[model samples]
Target: MSANPFSLQSLSRTEAAVDPAFVFDGTMVSRAEFSEKVERTAAWLAAQGIGKGDVVAVWLVNRIEWIALLFAAARIGAVVAAVNTRYRSAEVAHLLKLSGAKLMVVEAAFRAIDFAAILADIARSEVPALQKLAVVGADAVPAHWPSVRFDAFDKPYPPAPTTQEDVDLPVLLYTTSGTTKGPKLVAHSQRTLATHAASVAQALKLDPQRHFLLAMLPFCGTFGMTSLLGFIAAGATIHALDAFEAAPALKILSENRITHSFGSDEMFRRILSLTDAPRPFPHLEICGFAAFQPGWRELAAEAEARGMKLFGLYGSSEVQALFSIACPSDAFADRIEGGGWPMSPDAKVRVRDTETGQLVAAGVSGEIEISAPSRFLGYFNNPEATHEAITADGFFRTGDVGRLRGDNVFVYETRAGDAMRLGGFLVAPGEIEDELKACTGVADAQVVAVDLKGNARCVAFVIPASEPPQQDKLFARLRERLAGYKVPARIYVVDAFPVTDSANGVKIQRARLRTMAMERIAAE
Candidate 1:
């Protein structure tokens, strides 16, 4: 096994060959077998005209095939563009066009959503670069298009030559949840990802003896993918689930004696809410979580009583997943503080004044800026956005407000813009606003995030063009156009919006609207 951690081949070689790498739906795959599958998949992709810099979009749920495709694409120097499985036709079309994907691997259907039908809605002209579509979990390809089954890649093909320099080039493209604007394509190189993975494994104390349970979180996002790769680098066994159902997840945790896992605060709450009786996991050791709310302290204490150490984690797609994590030796208060010390010694963290661009005193909240070796390269095909995000001195502005307590510990505040974290995903109110405004009888719409029992919920205020739009009809329209999570929970019809004077012009006061929403929800 090699010590060099620059490429996928080197990382896989570090793991024990006979160790179990993945256990998906009751089938365990050894590290050696996993490596061989990656090599064979890479060769098949290369035979299909995928080469260095080509984009291969993977649109599947948490499965062994999804993980194999990610590594296989990197092995052949092709970039893997992960498409969120919850995306509708409109969202899927935008990502396909933006990534310029040469090949797409998708599931036949998931949770009763017809993926083939959604793809059929997209015109060929919208994604001219997408040459082929491979359907997974299907007996045969549908007759609507020239598609093939995912298992058709059994024949061997010659592999492409890869170099260390090639490993430094972008090999993965992940979409941001889109806070202020539409989702941007974040590009990450193999070297950057591998370095971050090793750092995360060390911080989390993962090893060959650990068994990790992965559920709910999609591999398309940085959080899940980083954890997946980190566990793989540590030679740990991964137990995967198609979705996050409380009953099934609890059963997996207890039956498998899972040692580690990651999830949002809400996910843990739902699991705990499943029963009044204590669900014990004697082997459970550590669990990393983010987006912690006030109620999480009780849940953390309960999990601790059950022998599980739950800690806070903070990171983003632009920062290569986790730059900060709580150490096991830290105090219980510090562990729940949302952001901990930097995971890597080379990573630098600072809180700077939003207006002056100067470093602020410790304990003072400001924009969180970071300079790290494992940071993402830049946004794909969008140099202007990249330039705006990265500073002149190489620090990336995280768009998050936070403060350093002392030495290295940091506390997270809120987003600088009007973004909100809902169900463990960052979402931009603008996207939902656009959909609402397009509905019949809607003249204008403004969306804001309101705190409801420690959970961020979208509340939309709309001005009708004529008669007020039927709430049920409007919601149905939104359901068809956007993901279910993006739909607003409550809608309020307003005659006009409250505006505030700004330097540029009058702006809608989202903060005021948020207050109004809280009061309204309370009254209801």
Candidate 2:
């Protein structure tokens, strides 16, 4: 295939040239109008002395203007460092300084949180690398800081389009994981990101007529960037939301006539549980889910009963979605027959053994690796990490366990790091923990497998809310949610799990509770 104009500039051009009157933010911003914002912002970016290859950190929630900054940075060829909107002073400061970002665009205040206060606490002066700061949603700019009035910034401009070399870097910066694990900087260039966009559009079957409202975070990670760009590529109308509250999201679906959306299984369950959720919008088409805990299919079925096509798409922070996607229309036999994805005729899938580093036979479980055009170049500034992730032959090691079938489809077994061998069958802890969360009194839970003299033992840790979570109750829940082998051999109840969030509400540490669980087990 030829190298198409797949960058933001080209995508903007397509949206404007084809669908000029498309509504964004309850008003139609003709393609020309949107492109003009891109230009004016690009020009302002140039004026701030931000040139190609520089980093422009964006710190804000999902909004039209937040997207404007992202496109603006792309147009100027600057890498957009998408900082989590929930980052507190220290976390925000660390990202801004670490990325060597010379400029930042943030919300002055939103909801009840004062972003200005958070910025002030971080102290820009402490980081000399930051030269300029722009705040939206505020009237009075700080004495020492520069601000971009959201309305004024949208004024039309006919600035010249940036050169090819100018819009090279697609995205940069680290994304915080579930636990306090150090953030890993994941980088992708224009080419890699565009490929991802193409994959999403193909998999979801999005088109110009389909409008999508995303409930996930608007950042550089797997959930936001890839999905948004895919919608843009499809020339689909993207309805923006500041955050995901089941009530408002359902209302948005009813009001905006949202046809498609994406979220975690937890979020989808909440939406399905909403008493006021619409029976089904005539325009509603698809609802893609990620990060399944367990009982996800039941929720998907509930959404399907309401006329939405629900699906489970697996992906990672390192490689934006589409590693594997389960279509809602697939029969139970199809799921058992190695699964399915919206694959082009040329796509390939393989399962390889972790121990021998060789391809595995059909129906045999092994590590799932990819040799796809859409995979990232590698992790940013960490060649060793990259080397471990990607193979000598160009395949990206997915770190996921799966098995191939005679039908050429791949069945995901579990995450390589999280799967345990129990009585000759592999047991995935996530599957168990997901089921445990469904218990009436259980607030949250986690499971880990310990190897003991050639045998595997499962340990489970649980969190109770207002009432004590009985082991028998938890066991019954597990029995209902999972197979016997996948159940934990033992269970431990805890007062609370360890978690840390940025001021903006980004989950920084997920595995901290696991460590705490291990410590408690040792003491016992």
- RMSD of each candidate? 11.2, 4.5
State every prediction's TM-score relative to the real structure: 0.78, 0.82
Query: Tens digit of lDDT per residue, candidate 2, span 408-437?
Result: 566666667677776666566656776777
Off by over 4 Å in 1: 1-4, 15-18, 139-145, 152-165, 179-181, 210-216, 275-279, 292-294, 418-524
* Candidate 2 TM-score, true structure as reference: 0.82
Top-TM-score structure, candidate number: 2
Model 2's alpha-carbon lDDT is: 0.64
Kindly report which residue stretches of model 2 are placed more than 4 angstroms away from their true locations once superposed: 1-4, 13-25, 123-126, 139-162, 166-181, 210-220, 276-278, 292-294, 322-324, 332-347, 405-408, 421-425, 430-445, 451-456, 462-487, 493-510
How much does candidate 1 score in TM-score?
Answer: 0.78
